[model samples]
Target: MAQLEQFTTPLDAVVSRMRALGAALPERDGVAVFNRVYLAVTEEVGRQLDAGRFPDPGAAITLDVRFAERYLSAVDAAAGGSRPPACWRPLFQFRRHPGVRPLQFALAGINAHIGHDLALAVVDACRSLGCEPAELEDEFDRVGDLLTTLEERIREDLMPGPDLLQIADPITHLLGAWSLERARDATWAAARALWALRRLPELAEEFTERLDAAVGLAGRMMLTPLPG
Candidate 1:
């Protein structure tokens, strides 16, 4: 209980920062679209933490904070005129383009965060807690479950209606190409691989780089501009 309380301040700080971004960005901006979705999800995670929903609160907090910090760091880098990782560049670069749909923005952000940042975050939590990926599996599953639910909600809320959607729509094809469940599964596998390769710094570095580039490619595809 005491340890859990210790995490409240930092967790609250992350939530506050996300809320500020949600409010500050324009509604139609791609970053803003995704920020709103992410902010709501963060708030829910915080609430779950307060309600004692996670089996291991400390692990959960560490994973949540580490996950959020990656997104925040990218935001800071863009604000400071520095380059964010390739996985994140597409979303930030195309954030304000009128041709991109809100659903694309939301999913692109999710792809960058989950497909890239999440695997890294699992490794981060493992290092922070001085444990292995196995030790954090419960926390990882819980967080992934939350994101899965949120991803469904985001699609429902942002996707065009059946009347607006078409079989030949580019967005439809893009949507068909990605799956949040698959991403979550892959991230778990990546985390386990990273933990196993912890002693092989060079190999692990190469694996991480490849993972980043592959995820960035998927994000770039997700951000493909439509014929609005």
Candidate 2:
């Protein structure tokens, strides 16, 4: 019982912050669009935690909270006029562009989060919990499954109606080129590589920077504006 209470504070704090962001941002703002999607996922995570669904509740809480803080930190950086991480730059830059669809915003955010942040979050959780990445595999898989399900719903809900989805629609091809499953797989690999390289600070830093830039590039491509 005490352990559950211990896990609740951090999760509740993050959930509260997400809810505040959802209420504060404009409905159609790209960041807001992503924020709504993330808020839903975060709330669901809390529910799962409360229901005692995770095998290691402490590990789950650490990973989930650490994962969310990275995104929120980027938001704070941008809001404070500091440069956000490379992986997050495109979404912040294109957040209000009329040409970018809501679906694009949502996917771009997911791409950045999964591709860059998830890897680091794994490391963060491992360090905080004094465990190896392998120990967190179940937590990672469960979270990935949750995100995968949400990705499908995001596509279904934000995708244009049949009348609007013409063969010539660039978004159709643009979105098709990226796969959340592939991204998750790559992130897992990256996390393991990072854990291996942790002893080599310079190499780890370089690898992290390169990963951030690569993910940011994909995010930039995902946000490619289409003709309205």
Q: Per-residue CA lDDT of candidate 1, range 38-62, in tens? A: 8888888889988999888888889
> How many clashes show up per model?
0, 0
Candidate 2 C-alpha lDDT tens digits along 133-187: 9999999999999999999998888888673654567788899989989999999
Top-scoring candidate (lDDT): 2
Candidate 2: give the clashing pairs: none
Poorly placed runs, candidate 1 (over 4 Å): 1-7, 163-168
Model 2: lowest-lDDT 10 consecutive positions: 1-10
Residue pairs in candidate 1 whose N, alpha carbon or C atoms collide under 3 angstroms: none
